[model samples]
Target chain A: MTMYNQTTDERVDKALANSFLRQATRRATDRLRNNKYKASAELGNWEEWRAAGEAIRKNVISNLDYYLNQLIEQMEKRGVHVHLAKTPADAVTVVRNIVSEHNAKNVLKSKSMISEEIHLNHALEEDGIDVVETDLGEYIIQIAGEPPSHIIVPAMHKTRQQVADLFEPIAGHALSSDTPTLTRFVRTQMREKFLRGDIGITGCNFAVASTGSIVMVTNEGNGRMVSTLPRVQITLMGMERIVPSFRELDILLNLLARSATGQRFSSYTTILTPPKNTADPDGPEEYHLVILDHNRSEILGDKLFRSSLNCIRCGACFNVCPVYRQLGGHAYGSVYSGPIGSVITPLLEKDWKKWGHLPYFSSLCGACSEACPVRIPLHDLLVKLRMRKTQSGHTPQVERQIFKAYRYFFTREKTLRRALRLGAHLQRPFVRNQRITGGPPPLSNWTNSRTLPMVAPKPFMQLWADLKNKR
Target chain B: MSNTSDFISNLAAKLGRPTPTQPPPQVKLSVPQYQLSSSAERVSVFLQNWQALGGKGAIVRSEDETLQCLKQWFGEQPITWFKENSKALLAWDKLPTIAESAFSSLNWPLTRYSQSAFDPRDRYSIAASAELGITGSDWGISLSGTVVVKSDPLRGRAISLLPPRHLSFIESTKIQDNLFNVLEEVAALGSPPAAIEMISGPSRTSDIEMDLSIGVHGPIEVYVIVIDH
Candidate 1:
């Protein structure tokens, strides 16, 4: 009954049938891609920026232990409490304990993928604590009782009318299906929560080691409010999210903002070294950073997959991914989605039997790798994941057999020609207007969604031979 | 209170190395240097980029012109929420003396964090209730059109964050070519401040069907007045 319980096939079928979802995703993704292109072009020297970003991330990840220790020392020195979580349950336990200690009745959260990864909201709600999602996109999906459909734009699947429908009941009046009116309602609603909420939770975009600062890049300013208003603040960080210093942050942030939202900077990029000074009038009285290491070390152990951790979660890959353009994020059936998601989900989650199929979600077009600001070779990794899945004997029997037959016939020219001739004859009954619309079980899967081109009447090799004779 | 030893040591083990005691020597990469010749160029770039981000800005010769500019700008505003008279504006104590004097000379309302008579213990309630906030910025990044505001004893973080509109004074000399230069200056200081907010423009989001909406949680309108010292 939970969010990710559906099988991959079921989710893909459901997503494919939703026309509104398709339209919304296409419009949003197209605009995001165009904006990012313009912004990066305006910045000029984008490739050099990407190279510098890659270098910085590569350095921190290679020497992760050193930088993490440095970050911990600096944070503690600034009077911020730090906790380590070895598992998802451990992370949830730490957050739950923090809430219980404060006797907090209401909790406010900004957009954090790590919180979703650990299912922190459900854990708190189970204890009868009210958890409010403060980001506009996150708030929309939160009320709809759904998981985020996109990484940055969480409610990308919902239209303006859908959002208005969700808020009208809560507002106790009729509402207009307009962006300004809907946004104003949420602003009025969240302002009260920001003032009175007992504890605030946010994800760290980049943790600077030398200064012990947790950076949050947000357009909506919810991140600022979350860190500033609550008496206590909790930051959830995946362990690999670190930079050596602010010098490196400058480089990565240049790439991040342009790649994520195509802005020079998000409206508010706040660097907080928390547990404020005693003389300061605003900010958290107690600050806690929970560093979670849920299967990231295992990813770090594999040299091929180590670079995946270098992702800044900008969601640029999602915009350019061809597979994601059609299927959207929900079909991936996980917290992370798109190319980055496909590469990391199976490696991070324990249920390989379910998550193993995620790697096959890509068309291997290499657009994700091209779009990556930190330069993760996502398509190459997807191919590698497919190899790993096959090595583990997790691929479907039909697919394995199909590949086996393909390998057998493709090795010899004569046999391939004979097979092609056989296919041409066999496809005749199914072909309608030069397209194969229906076939047996395995072929039916392909034909059900889209048409397969009928085999050539005369094989190309034979036609080439005849042309050579005529010349 | 869980220790990081196990967590960090496991990562060290995975990397086939012992836990490091010191930070690694970083490979120096060349950053893109956005070179501008003069302070005038920097201020002009800042103003241009600031307006592109939907912020209003003006360059003034002195603090006296800044006061005059504020008076004229407020007078021209279509919104009446900030001008209704009693304690509607909050300003940082670190702002130049002209700000305090402008309140009396222009008969405008202003309150500081500590001096708020509303609630002594929770004086930030004044920040929460105020319609407008005015403060002095530490630095302005001309390349990104960002104003850096660092919180201190006299400057409350809420003053820049809690209000519906924010107005900040940035000395033209404080404008820099890029964020890297500002970070370098911050690093030169021994200890960083509690919080450093780099405000690029008014709070904004395009979440509702990708329609851009201003001021979701923070200030809807932000004005940057660059003073020539």
Candidate 2:
């Protein structure tokens, strides 16, 4: 699995301690929030559009077998070879075979999150094929030997100075920490890799089932370059990335662009059919489309969490998520982080022993669902995941026992009144500034992280006596 | 790569649905309509949007005017163009020279085709030496200031992408009311073009400190010549 080296809590603690990372995340997300607000405000009826997007996604997922087969048939007619992978390992082997067929040593890529989910880069490098990331941000992180922190902006965690540092070594000289200067260097450097790459690989933003084409949107031209320059073009996409028609694609495109970057449209949006036809030139000769199911099929059966697949990977949920804003992307210990990641990670991996902690990462604030372009109920899904985890007996014994005692005392009025009367006296030692600053054992643990107002000793009775005496 | 049958069955079983061979009809609803009223109004919206998107353009009345303005824009300066005689790209009668240079003249260190040899890079050299790339738009979207280009043997994808400045010719009639209008047209095609490229503005990214930087990978400057009939 391509995840963080540390456990979720330890990673979050480390991220929180890094004041620079926290500051950067806060500044970036705040700006993103304002921009998204402005963009959606300009386009009237954004909510209606979101609802339609959600409906389109649901309709497509329910009829996925029909739509995907339709897409494959049309694609085959257009001369595109299609592959279906039941597992990540199977997907990797399918891609490996394509690379092997070309005797490909040089590979260029556009950013694909699904590829990261399968750890495609490592597999290829292990096979002795060199892979170059074409997008400017992706290239920086690739050379830095790190996965993307944010989906849209991969190097969001890195400062310009760090980017300069990363590039200077590659350039074999010193460079300035200026944005324009850094961007120029990357453009010049990656242009060579884009042109020379023998095989080009990308992730599909949305595959149009009606038209048998794949759509990609990017700010930089790397998406165009990789798909155009190489002799072979391969797009590895999740099985669910299908839109029925151009009409649906239009609305989804608007939703994705507005929710992702607060733009009316991205700088570049391309619709590519087959690699090349007999009449065309200067494009790939062979095209391959791989659809990976890899645990997503199980999600289609889940009633409460099935809508989690409606995500367009906009990263808006990350920007608005309170927990994600605090811990940053690295703390989630997965390729995907934030509310969506929390719901999908455990469900995908099925190793609740390891990834169960993720579902609890959110505050249940419902901000993620509000920010979601497709209106997925991420908070509700998180709660359901937690319930499932507890039912599986994963809840710690001490916490379960504490809750059991609270249930007992709360069920009996006499026991509750007596417990409160005694607890008021016991809480005196921990009270400071009218709040509980310290307590004993488990009580102390709660006080250390949170401040609870001490229960006032019979304040209600005192108030009633004062009113009666005045009257 | 087992047939999609197994994958489809697995998903259908999970979703508790019968295996469907054909998709259901699209659900129609009272979708909100968005449109631009007049060509003049659209032109105004397009130019305003063009500037906001970090692109520049000039509205011309005829192809001759477009050529004249383009000539005026790049007076006596050398340019690189794809096959210039196509109706899409107006023929140049007496323009600056064109280069058929191999990848050798370019400073890139890598080559995708077997025909070009690998060479070392020069830190100061640019990928495309010419300052301008000229192409034609098959259609335009006034709402978003997007020009759609189709790539083929003569019109390579690199022509519009590699240059620091890109010059695109758009027929005024080709300008649609909005992106929906554009997609509808594209969908109507019997068989869509191999590649359809939509250039909204100069390439940009805000990855570094959230600063807006334009022309990172493609043209830093773009000029759309709207040719009115």
Candidate 3:
């Protein structure tokens, strides 16, 4: 399957050319980062909390099977229907079957990255089910017929004027380019969907293994609307999204809220044990939890990449990533983006040669790793991915040839010194003021943006030899 | 439905181990704790935090003060709006007798929410139509200014959710220092209720250009009357 619509450079070029997207991403990320900094600092021991969060996630992932089993048992015990989906297609089919069995027409969805991963909306829409995205950002993107650009703020790339344009046609008239005006319009639109939606599809933030409950941390309260209003509630959960109990949840929730949106807590943290009690007034009557593997087990097996599963989907790393700051999520051309996305996309796709170039999306700066609340060593993982790509012989032929020549030359000091001596003379034509201003194909690619310092007049080894003689 | 056993077993194989029958011992990790020395500190911190989250309310020493607070809130609204509108208040049926009497005395159209009062669908629409929702919070976390509400057979979740404005009473004694303490209290119960929500503030979103918009899908305004008595 062609997951990325554009080539990597093409995508980056397109994102870079869009000045509005650049400004929007920078503004949104800066605000989010500032908020996160304040929120984490308010706790007085942010590192301790992050460490505790990392430990909890590490423990849960290490014993994922046990927790999955316990969660399934508890959910079933609570009269919730549990389905295991091994692939994206399997998950789509499960949701489709549930929709058909209930003969449901309208499906209201909250913001869920997994749902995007599984391509739930397109599949359901093809089946002629009216699926509505309830989260304001999701709703905006849904109407715009676009994929989410950011995890938390899906419409981060959209300006208020752009949003006004998107809502104008829906409202059957022009609307103002003000946040409140736009928000009120969508609120009216979504309330009808919430009340009339037959099935509520939500993404599980954390599935409590001990209690058989799904936790939703949302600011818009759409999560609550989806879970509580619809008759049939279906939660799409990645197999790794599990906490041992509510106790672990306390730590993770604190970390997630502070990291994701820089709030002491999200507006609503709903811990719902589904299939409301027999006498309960208004929660969903039928509850279904889809436990999806979708190559997560493959990731879990590779010790190097296993920690990526510990991500709470907080998107904190994205804010701190310099590459992401330059090129918004869309530039990555994956449902997941930023440093974490660079590390995992190839692993999840299992075609390093095809998706392997994603690791280059990073600058090797460890800001992502430092910003990560769960302490996923994202920068290290990206480097390892690059290494894996080379080991698997996925490097470009020209690049490989250069490396091969270097390996041969370095092995013979005489040949290396001879080649370097010749190169310094050959570069004279392109050299200007001790910098290479222009060169041929491979060299020009680097020189086009920034001049490269002429290969030092004397190689480092030669300089060392002269210094040794002077000593 | 696909069998979970095969799925889990396959995962176990990837981990280079069999699916163990027993769960590993859980490590005991200490959660970060916050403490306020006195109830006064708790109430002040909670009110301060709540206001910071765009919530408006005050601490009242007596039930009469709580009534006066609610009455003054209505007084701020133009009387004509209530007259032309439903003038309805959606409330949890089991509110403290004082709040219940206060609601009756307001002489406004009131919807007391209970499972048996209306069908499932009707409860949502009714709550959605009401101008305000009033309920009692089980606990309040002081640091975050969060109100913990439980949904059971007797109470509908929509009481605090569907309405645009929500006012809930939280007893000062029930205020906890932080979310950790409130969570510990919930876990101490045999099991979680059908649904429990830790609502920190009014529904808000910053999706469009990172502009803050309140009450996108839930209550736009939330108030908590912390009764110190």
Measured against the true two-chain complex, the DockQ scores of the candidates, in the order shown, are 0.72, 0.42, 0.77
CAPRI category for model 1 = medium
The segments of candidate 3 whose C-alpha lies over 4 angstroms from its true place after superposition are A1-3, B76-87, B115-117
| Local distance difference test values of all predictions, in order | 0.88, 0.79, 0.87
Q: Comparing to the true complex, what docking class would candidate 2 get?
A: acceptable
Tell me the tens digit of each residue's lDDT in model 1 across A1-471.
245787888899898999999888999999999989998988778898888889899999999998899899999987888999888999999999999999999899998999999989889999999999999999898889888888989999998999999999999999999899998998898887888889999999999999898999899999999988788999999999998888888888888898998888889999888888877777888999999989998999999889999999999999999888898889998889989999998999856698998888988989999999999999999999888888889888899999999999989999999999999999998999999998898999899889998889998999999999999
lDDT leaderboard ranking: 1, 3, 2
Kindly report the root-mean-square deviation of model 1 from the true structure over all alpha carbons: 2.6
TM-scores for every candidate against the unseen true structure: 0.95, 0.90, 0.97
Candidates arranged by TM-score, highest first: 3, 1, 2
lDDT of 2 by residue, A135-178 (tens): 88788888788887788877788888888988988899999999
The candidate maximizing DockQ is 3
- Please give the ranking of all candidate structures by DockQ, highest first, separated by commas: 3, 1, 2
Which structure among the candidates has the greatest TM-score? 3
Predicted structure 2, TM vs. truth:
0.90
Report the TM-score of the second chain of model 3 against its true counterpart.
0.90
